[model samples]
Target: MNTTPQQNTQDRPARLTVGVVGAGRVGPALAAALQLAGHRPVAVSGVSEASVRRAAALLPDVPLVTPAQVLKAADLVLLTVPDDALPALVEGLAETGAIRPGQLLVHTSGRYGTKVLDPALRAGALPLALHPAMTFTGTSVDVQRLAGCSFGVTAPEELRLAAEALVIEMGGEPEWIAEESRPLYHAALALGANHLVTLVAQSMELLRTAGVEAPDRMLGPLLGAALDNALRSGDAALTGPVARGDAGTVAVHVSELRKHAPEALPGYIAMARMTADRALAHGLLKPELAEDLLVVLADGANGTHGTDGADGTDGANGTDGAPR
Candidate 1:
């Protein structure tokens, strides 16, 4: 992830003394990356044991101090606290006169934009939302993962250039997320990343419940390929029973889930319906075929018996579970 060299842009951003308000998963990683790019992390505020250990490991020799001390010692303040905690922290800092004008304040929260930093801005500070689009494990390894990543950046027009330059220095591509669109932008990430994690965990659990000892061995390749194709082709990458409009097979899947793993049925049905909808909209399944599949899904929705819609629309070898 060679993030050592930064592009010498015509409008270069100056390296400044940095203060990290939270030395949690994201803060230390950003601080380390910024340090690698020439900025100095003078102090950081960390309360939890994990945060303290993480800061020591990632930002070695950097002093762990109070939030007030952190703000007082730096030119750039990186506020990497939890999403819901940001506004109050900013207000408190502003109220105490800890944050002064001319300093730049950036937060790594994807759920918010520069608006959340209103208090600091009113007190004469530059505000930026510089969210890196990658998960962190609160380790030094995260520093290397910054390369070629996209950063959701939100800032006032005058500060956009400098914010983007910082991303480039840290080896990330800057993506401008509109202030009003921040919520929707964050929702998409949550749905895509967080929901994917839940779905996979559920699938693995169901596999184990079905007596599959090596669930990962069976799932790893298939999931990896599906994810890769989905990224490359969007809805066009869809495959299997739903995409093929195999009503009988779909019914069988619902029945098996309900009979053996009732707990997983709801999510399975929901995802199946969503897949059918996307397949229909993307022209992957014909209108008639999609209508047939939807009926089976609707039957599964009503009860554990997936037989109602399986009579007329099923393929010739109905119970064989073969795709169209």
Candidate 2:
């Protein structure tokens, strides 16, 4: 879809009226941000009473209404419902003729784009996707952090401009993405943000099993440094025994894991093999060394035993045994 910038408003509009449906973690946070950006959150709705109560507390001046009422009152309707519920909600709204011809319909789901709003589009509404590439921890702290974050925007030609404008108004940089590429982009975010949580949890469990008290304290500095390095140098920041192609050290880890944290072995092996592949791509490991390291990691995956190297020490070359 075309992504030309919308007609620039020299001055911000005086309180653009907004309606928020689904007062879950993301919904209320976004509604709060909209309010901060000089928007009037005129209506709020959600499936659960608790969610509705939460939204009412956040936007006490706004009326708590049914989804249909929100649609009717809002110039811009935000479907902050869970991703799976969005299509059904749009269909229901369209069937009820609640959506106006020129109203802007937006959703916060990262996994989907404007396609989920097909029903709204059929009813002549502008469909837009405005997904902030960040996690919601269900706190005001998260809402405060929304400023200057990157948002993934996708929509039809006419709606794309509106989507970009909205994101900019929210103090976020808009990254235009093809509608069909939303899934891949979401997956990348999941890998980096969500899976990183999984990896750290697994590592912490391993450390706990190894008798490390206060695992969080021990991991904090190490993770902080690693993250800083990754941000500054990308893949070049890789380190540790796996990046070094130190087969002997890896074998030691496998043996210790088998005894201490067998449950974490599979994840360790998977991440190690993936890291080895990255190291190879960076030319840090010779093909033979990479193959050997892969074998060790694969053995861990398969619950099998493997020798680290011929000499029972690290591999022959110091370069092969140093961290990448």
Candidate 3:
């Protein structure tokens, strides 16, 4: 993938003084990418000794220091800690009065906005959230993948330009998202990216049970094509038995799942219901057909139909015979 050239000149001179907290997957990756983009990573710190060592190996000459030292010496502080630890870290930094006014504090957590850094913000430092929409598996492959990725950025209006400038400096497109919408936006990414991994693992397990020698080999082509199609055309890429509303095929699938893969029944039904909803949204299925498909999946979930008024007649599929 091609990336825009790093913006550095005598006038601009690429802000090279960076401090990174948390030497986990994203921290090291970001540090490496920043170095490649002409930024200087001056100080690095993490809770785990192994993580610290890993980060040290990446930036061999950079100083390893405490979080407080990082805040004092670096113009840009990157907090790549775990999501749950973020607020506490910021609060701790604030209590110590370590954050200086006008300093840039950024985090790489996908699920949060600058709100998690409220303490730092209160201390007069600029808070920025820059989350890349790609997975980082702590491998050399990630270095290549970072190029051309999209980064969701959220910051105070006063600091928005600087946040966007940093994102572009790292060879990523800066996508602005409202602070209030951060959770829902992150939820969409989790559902579409993270949960897809679980779904694929489950599929591979089922394929293994069915005697496929190499499930990944079998799935690679099919999934790759599906992903490509979805990327190119969005919902218009829908296909397979559910997209076609093949009730008979779905029934057979439920039956087989019950016998050979009872563990997968719940996921299959839930995803089928979701697909029915999407099909309805796309105008691919008539209201009645979509409702019927949902009912079939829900009925399987409860092990019976027409009992407890849970026959999926509650419009869960969003096909109430009204205009979409």
Give the winner by lDDT. 1
The CA lDDT of each predicted structure is 0.87, 0.81, 0.79
Report the number of the highest-TM-score candidate: 1
TM-scores for every predicted model? 0.91, 0.88, 0.86
lDDT of each residue in 1-324, candidate 3, tens digit only = 644543333234555688898878787777777877777788988777778677866767888889999999888899988888998989999999999998889998888998888888889988999998999876556767877889999998988998888887777889999999889989999989999899899989988988999999989988898899989998888876667665545665676688898888999898888877787799876786666566667778887533212233323332332212
- In the range 181-258, model 2's lDDT, one tens digit per residue, is 999999999999999999899878777876899899988988999999999998889887777667777876786788
> Candidate 3: lDDT of 79?
94
The local lDDT score (0 to 100) that residue 68 gets in candidate 1 is 92
The residue-level lDDT of candidate 2 at 105 comes to 90
**Which TM-score value belongs to model 3?**
0.86
Off by over 4 Å in 2: 1-13, 308-310, 313-324
lDDT of 1 at 316: 18
Clashes of each: 0, 0, 1
Cα RMSD, each candidate:
3.8, 5.8, 6.5
